[model samples]
Target: MAGLAVPTWDPQTALLIGAILFEAIVLYVGYGGLERLVGPRLMELLVGGDSGVGQ
Candidate 1:
């Protein structure tokens, strides 16, 4: 005969969950900083078109 098993809360499971949450927060903050640094340059490149030099 065979038996069925169910999942339970344990230290390893908690550690893995915590690690994933930490990674999500880190990525969010990092991408936000990168966007802030590069967003202005990208907007200028898209909208300026390099024609307004002497104006």
Candidate 2:
């Protein structure tokens, strides 16, 4: 028997959590950059050439 199997705050678990958080931040920044580059143009195309953002 492995005796009282209590959970421990392992380094691997901490690292995994950190990696997930880093990925989320990176994705957010990437999407925000993409939006800044193309969002207004995309909106204009969809709304027939009058972009509300520019005004």
Candidate No. with top lDDT: 2
Candidate 2 lDDT by residue in tens digits, 1-55: 5877977898999999999999999999999999999998888788865557667
Worst 10 residues of 2 by lDDT: 46-55
How good is model 2 by TM-score?
Answer: 0.75
Q: What is the lDDT of candidate 2?
A: 0.89
Each candidate structure's TM-score, on Cα atoms with residue i matched to residue i, is 0.67, 0.75
Q: Tell me the whole-model lDDT of each prediction, alpha carbons only.
A: 0.83, 0.89
